[model samples]
Target: MRSRPKEPRVPPDRRETVRHEIVSLLTGESMTAREISGQVGIGEKEVLEHLGHIRTALRSRLVVTPPACLECGFSFRKRERLGKPGRCPVCRSERIVDPSYTID
Candidate 1:
């Protein structure tokens, strides 16, 4: 009887790098910081930090859909940061939509 070759196995702890994983996820669809955090099992703040670095490091465009105020319909187009703004300047409403990110 001929013996079959053993297949190499990857360790359970071995996983794709966080940034790479994030890139893959973003490639499929746009996601908010909170959504990315939930998918990657990381804090939302950390996700934003990673996104900041990815924005600079990635050759492909990293597009940011800025958050908008739900109440006043104000868009945060000029905002620099990735995180959601505290309040809307037009209406002073705290109800705001989260910014989404995508790689194009």
Candidate 2:
């Protein structure tokens, strides 16, 4: 039987660049951390870490789209920093699209 080839490991710097690109794409629309991870070909936790750096780079330029609850239509406006919300205050729905951004 033929063995599958191993995928090349992405360098840390390249991973950061990928994260930056993903953040740029995410500026127009909100996306989950999982989605960003998939796009960047990295782990969700890694994506979150990248987000922290991206947020710092963006600083006051950060533009959060505000996550809306799919079930209850609850919009998260003045909640806190970026990350998955525990639950919707209105209907307690876990489904949410956290805001992300990039430098213009």
Candidate 3:
């Protein structure tokens, strides 16, 4: 198994701009948090936070499809949080699909 070196974190002052940039990027296609983090050079957790802000900033333009349990097809539409759930409540399955976001 191999590990990659870490990338430098985006400065606090620039986070706002990055968040806006993220929204602009999403206008073209839906993307998961991991993909956003990799492309934006930030951590996954940071990407999640930015997503929340994006939701607030672009209420009419943003569209988020909540994650679902692949095994039992349980939808997380009721969950208010921004990240993926750990397990499925109906079937207790760990095979959950990640939520995706896009800007309309």
Top lDDT prediction, candidate number: 1
lDDT tens digits, residues 1-104, model 3?
A: 99899998876556457887798779879999888888887898999998888788777577778999999888999887879889999999999999988987
TM-score of candidate 2 to 2 decimals: 0.63
Reference-based lDDT, each prediction: 0.89, 0.71, 0.86
TM-score of candidate 3 to 2 decimals: 0.80
Model with the higher TM-score, candidate 1 or 2:
1
lDDT of each residue in 1-102, candidate 1, tens digit only? 999999997644538988888888999599999899998877899999999889989853889999999997999999889899999999999999999999
lDDT of 2 by residue, 43-66 (tens): 877777777777777775656567
Model 3, CA-based lDDT: 0.86
Estimate TM-scores for all models. 0.83, 0.63, 0.80
Off by over 4 Å in 3: 1-16
Error of 3 at 19 (Å): 1.0
Looking at model 3, the pairs that clash are none
Model 2 spans > 4 angstroms off: 1-20, 23-31, 98-103
Clashes of each: 0, 0, 0
